[model samples]
Target: MTSGKKTEKYKLILDAAVKVFAAHGFHKAQVSKIAKEAGVADGTIYLYFKNKEDILICLFKEKLGELVEKFHLSIEQTTNAKDALRRVCEIHYGELEAQVDLAFVTQIELRQSSLELRKEIGKAVKPYIVLIEQLLLQGMEEKLFRQDLDVKLVRQLLFGGLDEVVTSWLIAGRKYSLSAQIEGTINFYLNGIKA
Candidate 1:
C-alpha cells in the first residue's frame, strides 16, 4: 500500500479503537470489535498495530500529541499566565466534554490497562505535563505566582486537580456540564499558586 493509504488506515483503526475501548473497557474490548467499527477486516487491524495494547498506545500517542498542540496554540496569544492557564483548562475540559467517547477512553478505560501499558501512555502525556509546568513557570516569572513555589510539585497538583474534575464528571455519568467547571477549577488552583 502507498504511504498515504497506510496512514489513513492506521488513523481509522485508532479512531475505531477509541470507540470500542470506551464502550467496552480495555480488557473486555476485542480487536474484532474495533475492526468492525472501522469497517475493515479483523486482520486489517493487525496491519497497523500488533494487538489491542498497541492500538491503545498508538491512540494515546496520536490523540495526546494533537491535544498538546491545541493547548499550545490556545495560549500562544495570551499575555498573562492566568489567562493561559484558564485557556488550558477551557480547551482540556471542552475537548473532553465534546468527545465523550474519547473522554471515556482517556479518563477511564486507559486506567484499566496494565502497568506497562499505562507507563507507555504516561510517556505520551509528558508533553502536556511540560505545558502545564511552562504555564506555572510563566506565572512565577511574571510575578503572578509565588516565587517560592516548587514548580514541579505545583505542576503535578494543578494537573492532578484538573484531571480529577473530569474523572469525577465521567464517573458521575456526566449529568452536569464538564466544561462549566473550568472557571471554578482554575480559580481553586490559582488560589494556591498565585502570588
Candidate 2:
C-alpha cells in the first residue's frame, strides 16, 4: 500500500516534471532534471515513475483528471445549460491563464508526444467530453437548445473551438488573458443552439 508520504512525493515529482518538460521539451527533459527540480535523488524518480514517457502520461492523468472533476462540479452548480457552459469556459480559460507551466506543457509540449502517447492522452480526455455532451443533452431536454440539433457534433464544436482558442493563445506567447474570451466563446456557440 502507498503511504501518504509516497503519494505526496509522487505529486511533487509530477509537478516538477511539468516545469522540466516545459523548459526543455518532453524529448529533451531527463529523469535527473525532474528529480533535481523535485528536490529528490535521481533514483527516487525511478521509484515513482518508470521513465520519461511514464512521467508525461502521469502528468496528463493528474492534471486532466483534476480539470475533469472540476467540470463535473461546475455543471452541478449551474441550473441552466448556458450558465454551465460559461462556467466550463471559465474553468478552462481560467486555469490556462492561471498557470504558465500548465499552459505551455498542455498546448505545446504535450502535442510533441508520439502517436501512441497521443492516443493514450486522447483516451484520458473522454470523461471531459462526456461531461460536455451531458450538458448539451440537458439543454436539449429543457428546450433551450434545438430539438433537432446533434449533441455529438455540438459537443465536438464546443470542445474543439475552446481548445483552438487556448492553443492559439499559447502559440502567440500568451499575450492576453484567455479567461477574457469566455463570454464571447459562449455566445459564439450559444447563438446557433438557442431555441
Which candidate number would show the highest lDDT if scored against the true structure? 1
For candidate 2, give the lDDT.
0.88
Residues 70-97 of candidate 2: C-alpha lDDT, one tens digit per residue: 8888778888988888899999999878
Q: What pairs collide in candidate 2? A: none
Cα RMSD for candidates in order: 0.9, 1.3
lDDT of 2 at 28: 91
- Name model 2 segments beyond 4 Å from true: none
lDDT against the true structure, per candidate, is 0.91, 0.88
Model 1: per-residue lDDT, tens digit, 76-138? 889899999999999989999999999999989877778999999999999999999999888
Q: Tell me each candidate's TM-score.
A: 0.97, 0.95
